[model samples]
Target: MTGGPTLPALPPSLRAPLGLVAVLAALVVSVIGTLYAGHSQPGRVDRWIVSPTADPVGPPWRPVALTLDFLGEPAGSVLLVGVVVAVCLLLRRPRAAVLTVAGVALAVGTTTLLKQLVGRTIHGPDNLSYPSGHTTFFTALGLALALLATDRLGLGRTAGTSLVLCVALLAGAAMGWAEVALGAHYPTDALGGWCTALAVVPATAWLVDRAADRLESAGRPEPR
Candidate 1:
């Protein structure tokens, strides 16, 4: 989606900081929400969200449900990250590739830790369901892909970002819905997972940009 001619592209310096702050805020809210949900007694919202999907609604949604579930698995997560990294490298954006991989890894690790720490229970046998690992991985991957598309693919600031945001929201909603339908997580768990990704990906990108700038500066010749 192209913006109007009057729409100005944000400078990299400003964009990075703003994105980081927004993501951090999301992470904080997600963390607090998850903790509250875990500690509080199961309420109407939790029941209402999980009930419809507890048992399969029909045959039509089965395939989509299965696909989304699979995509959130470790193998699926790895594949998604690999594809994003490969795309970035193919675009000759090594920093993007590195940042994507690192960001995903950090997000996954943090989610795992939070799951154990929070110890949120769902209908499933697994007790560590506070934040859905699958959702976290996929969300992070989506964000990384969006960043690459905007920064490297020359898709323009507005169009590329808007496209990526739409894709990421769809992907995240699908994954979260599938998890709930399968009785693997509560709605809050999925929210927490998204929050984790929001926090990690932008922070990682900012760090990568800073590191790249430092390296570039170091490699420059000294003025005589």
Candidate 2:
């Protein structure tokens, strides 16, 4: 499994701080999500950003928003992940391919579970909308790619952290905007979803690395 390209090592300098930030941000977002549980109206932050309405954004950008929103849909996500995984395999970065799948799956799954637990709804009673799963999905993908890039390029702490965060922020914001503009989620829901991905991906990456290491160690032949 750890055959080609030496399996880019997760930078020791970048791991701890990123993990800490993710944990703290997730906690804060969760708390805010709790505050608006079972609510139908937009909170102050959500209203300030944009009102909760069907088709909050109009023409010109509407198509663009829909395109982005589709990327979070089942077929879109599968296609997106499949492309990245294929690329990783082509590059002989198996661990990276694994991370991409695991990170995204974990991030999206976390949001789904949180939606049920938080019970924050919008538009309709049965429509759960605490954390924006679309935002979480895109952010997770970006984070996985960022981590792979950082490791492959051997970036230092500052650079790696910056790269990961920048990618995550851009991805999350893009999808979040789409979700909110379409009135599919509240702005705060988007924020929570973004933070959820930020919290989940890094930890998932670390776990992937750890499991790979264990497998490699177990497969190693004893020295004579």
Best by lDDT: 2
Whole-model Cα lDDT of every candidate shown, in order: 0.69, 0.86
Model 1 C-alpha lDDT per residue in residues 70-149, reported as the tens digit of each score: 87787877787788778766666777778778888998898888877776675544666767787888787877777766
Q: Identify the leading candidate in terms of TM-score.
A: 2
Clashing pairs in 2: none
Error of 2 at 150 (Å): 1.1
- What tens-digit string does per-residue lDDT give for candidate 2 at 45-68? 877777444446788999999999
Please provide TM-scores, in order, for all candidate models, with all chains considered together. Answer: 0.80, 0.94
Off by over 4 Å in 2: 1-9, 52-55
**lDDT (Cα, 0-100) at 22 in candidate 1:** 51
Q: Which 10-residue window of candidate 2 scores lowest in summed lDDT?
A: 1-10
Model 2 C-alpha RMSD to native: 2.1
